[model samples]
Target: MNAQDVINFLQDNPSFFEDNPDVLTQITVPHHTGGQAISLTERQVSTLREKLAQVQGKLSELVGFGEENDSISAKVHHLTLSLLIAESFESVSQSLYTHLTEGFAVPHVQLRIWNSILKRPLPEFVEVSEELLFFAADLQRPLCGPVQQAEVQAWFGESAEQLRSWALIPLRRDAQVFGMLALGSEDAQRFFPEMGTLYVERIGDLVSAAVLRHIG
Candidate 1:
């Protein structure tokens, strides 16, 4: 639970400790006492208090973490909305790069579109890298960051250090790939199979619609 949640829970359930008076063994019983002796020792109670304090510290950390996560999620949602509002490939790509870097905190990304009928690359192409060009030729749908070192090395040819992780999303209309989005990051573990691809796929759907609207 987050810091606020943990704190609220503790506040509401103060009886959790109070009900178990043996938790606070500060008082000692006489040798010939009429009442039952407490099982917990003074040192044990002190340790429990220390443990509770640690839980409180972790709760505070979770509070901060929850806030950061919320911020990131909001930015991503905004970017997705902007993508839906875009009219052209240029606008979409610009907004996407800006959102990736400024909004989502990603490092770098490249978008490539291949017009099947025209047999030409989009205007955005600035001498496509050999690896990217090859990837496009393969026309893989929804590629994620490589896990193996060899795969990673191949994707990032010469300036591999500049890019760590990447996601290649193919834009298709009627099952034909017309464009691709290549997202890159400096962190190797950013994109993985365990993560959800719903957002990227949604972006792909928009890209595909845009491509058909523009070219068809």
Candidate 2:
């Protein structure tokens, strides 16, 4: 783990090893002699160090999750501010898409509006695979994270791998799905449900409102 993560994890889990006194004794010292306790030895120190390394690895995983969550939070904040100040839908969509791709380190992204006349979702942005680019644009209902992945992969086959993980968040207004913002990363884990969705959902709500005000 990095220095900040190390400090945060240690502070948060001060009692992580409390129940396992054997592990504690391996790293701690006896307060008094012949008091039914023993001090750590050189061998114990090595073992404790090994355990520390393992714990640090877990902490690093947490650090990564924290980073993604923080990125989404920042992007949502920026979008909120922009909405309050902006005057046009095009400007808002462009800014939002750029922020989404950059903050998530995704290589491809698209924003689309649900086209009721065509009975399908139409692509507002097309990158990489064009064959299935407009698949999610026409869906009248909100597509959740899991279903969105299935639909894209089903339409594109092997080509979807080039974009890796993808998330289609429905932009809803007046209880209707008006549009969606799709974010894609080369890493499959980037859009997995295990990852935080606070930012994505918040962005979806903003996009929905914008679409309602401008397109709905």
Candidate 3:
């Protein structure tokens, strides 16, 4: 009666085709490329081929994702080993900066420690605005996107103007946030709200543990 009804009837009675093989030759459907009407059998074959191509394309996409994850995991592993062997706060900073900037190719790194326990008046101990400290404390996960705070951008010093994007990782010790490690790049697309932050969050965890050793 209707196209859907015919489809349902054919689906329900799959043996109908085998019982009436002549129907396959009589039925003709428009060709996928839109020229002549082809036999139903030919159309079915064409449909299956299209489905197979789509499945293969999806499989290739999945393989690409797997390779990307493996690569990022390896880089994170290398950073872990580098931090594990660091002897002091200075070395920890060196190893973290070196691994992220050189190994991961992040162009700029900014670290700020706000805990009063940081007795040394190093650059890290430089005063941070209460607003920033609150923002860091409120972060449940790493923030990835265009620079969220303009003031934070100025912390990068001379490169502030050129840095258009940022990944702000909140460092926490004993569940309390203490500081932030900011990664900066000139490319706006380098960091965005929709981007995955799994590895960046992992970096935050590693950095927090290493820095807390001396200042916590």
Please list the C-alpha lDDT of all candidates, in the order they appear. 0.66, 0.61, 0.89
Model 1 Cα lDDT, one tens digit per residue, 10-101: 79998866787765565554333346555446446656888999999999999997897687668767876887788865677788779877
Count clashing residue pairs per candidate. Answer: 1, 3, 0
Model 1, residue 159: C-alpha shift (Å): 3.8
Lowest lDDT block of 10, candidate 1: 147-156
- How far does residue 85 in candidate 3 sit from its true spot (Å)? 0.7
lDDT of 3 by residue, 75-185 (tens): 999999888888888888889889889988999998888874765657777888999988899999988878659778888889988987889999998788998999999
Where model 1 places Cα greater than 4 Å from the true spot, the runs are 1-41, 115-142, 147-158, 172-178, 192-213
Where does candidate 2 clash, by residue pair?
A: 120-138, 121-137, 121-138
Against the correct fold, how does model 1 do in TM-score? Answer: 0.55
Q: How far out, in Å, is residue 83 in model 3?
A: 0.6
- At residue 43, give the lDDT of candidate 1: 47
What are the per-residue Cα lDDT tens digits for candidate 2 across 1-216?
Answer: 799997898699888667566765566455333344455654466568889999999999999988967866786787677765656667667677666657546566666654433322334532324333355445543343344355555444465667657677767655555555666666766677566566667777777776556554
Predicted candidate 1: what Cα RMSD to the true structure? 10.5
Better of 2 and 3 by TM-score: 3
Please state every model's RMSD to the true fold in angstroms. 10.5, 12.5, 1.9
Alpha-carbon runs more than 4 Å astray in model 2: 1-43, 60-64, 115-161
The deviation in Å at residue 69 for candidate 2 is 2.9
Strongest candidate by TM-score: 3
